[model samples]
Target: MPASLALSPTPAPARGRLWRTLRQWWAVLLFGAVAAVYALSPSSHDARSRNATARLLHATSWQALPWFALLSALISLALIRTLVVTAQSYGLSQFALEMVVRVLLLELVPLGAALFLLLRVALAGDLLPQADPAGGLAPHALAAERWRLELLPRVLALGFAVLALATASGVLALLLAYTVVYGVTPWGLDSYTRMVGRVFDPAVCLALGLKTGLFAVAVAVVPLASALQEPYAAARRAAGFAVRSGTRRVLAVLVLLQAASLALKFL
Candidate 1:
């Protein structure tokens, strides 16, 4: 009896191990999907791609305006004040406004918006399903339609959210920086516009726009892909791993953006 029992093939353990392995690959698959989208982005002239681009812009800008404005204003005030004080201390006040535009507007705001959306929207998606007792769809179906429609859309929305916030904040910060430096006066407009025009050359503008779009896509696509790649049996074990995988995906996207921007600038 003991021999017969021992000889019995326990399929459960084998199945569990297979599930675990698949869960691990889910993260990898998510990263690949984001990369693929970037590579296969609809042509600039393609009507469908154009519409998608327009939708992304509208969603990010109009839908996310209020929250973005509030956050951007708070951050701008803190940064401007610090820059003003620091510049005065060093007798480098002349350079302060330029620095604010270059640092806060050009670099930080966009990245911050992306990160904020990742936390606010992307993380929430992960936690929401877990919190729902009757919440989750069956694993296979969830992997198919749900991921493409529900998860991808939210992620895409987040990308838009970040882009809209960044563009609005960058513009606002420019206005605020001028007021802080030159006071409320019409004379400053010419100088401000010149600086804006110089800073926003055609290439730089294109790069910035592309970067914002990419950031949005990265924030949305990676996490959902990770979750879907896992085997059904390992769903519970896969959750934490999937989040981590998503984070890595975000980081990779950021790095690639920076590299691309640099290459564009130099080349």
Candidate 2:
């Protein structure tokens, strides 16, 4: 291969692909920044916005917490029991606690929380009301108003739901794992805490936290981005297609994030 040829200007196709990728990510980042600013602005703390946020938060988190906790506890118990039996039979009993922490607490809880919030929001379609910009405001102003009054609160609510559910269910799973693996006694508390601490070292903890935040952001942002991509007329005309495509986008982002997390943790 000639040096000149190798060092020559990049091909058009490659440059085009790179440009497209940059453009896509830039849009996502820009949207996130605008949303964040709106969410944090003092004007957003108005009574109406606060009330909307609180109501949505209650519906998203409180309403789902009990059922989610019950389901997580049952599943955790079954898995813990099975893991204990299997480990004891296979002479790996000592590693059961670590396995539960890694698999159940770090992985399952966050993913399940994100999925639950996604499903709940999907089922309760159009959680945000359409805001009408008064006094013949410009398109940009109307969009800003909508983001502040309508989208920001719902996204905040759903994001809160994801974190709340993940935290609550994760704690419950840990307790259940301990109870099932070591009985209802305080004797194993030290060993259990040590193992959990070991499993959740700085690197693992960082990855888990990042993965959870990414999951929440993906769950909250993808649908909104997809909805915005469609013009009002087209969205109204092909609502089902818009929904199906949005779901696919959300799932793709989630799977990608999960794969990256696993790679970071184990690779």
| Candidate topping lDDT | 2
Weakest lDDT window of 10 consecutive positions for candidate 2: 130-139
lDDT of 2 by residue, 1-267 (tens): 888878848888999999965654555556566767777789877888888889888888998999999988888888878878888889998887788778898888999999877777666666623323232122234466667667788778877888899999999998998888878999999988888888889988888888888888877766655455445545556556656655777788889988888787678
| Model 2's TM-score against the true structure | 0.82
Give the clash total for candidate 2.
Answer: 0
lDDT (C-alpha) at residue 126 in model 2:
69
Which residue runs does candidate 1 get wrong by more than 4 Å? 1-65, 126-148, 236-238, 259-267
The TM-score that candidate 1 achieves is 0.65
Listed per candidate, the RMSD to the true structure in angstroms reads: 8.6, 5.6
lDDT score at residue 180, model 1, on the 0-100 scale? 82
* Model 1 lDDT tens row, 180-206: 888989998887788778877887777
> Which residue pairs collide, candidate 1?
60-160, 155-220, 159-216
lDDT assessment of candidate 2? 0.76
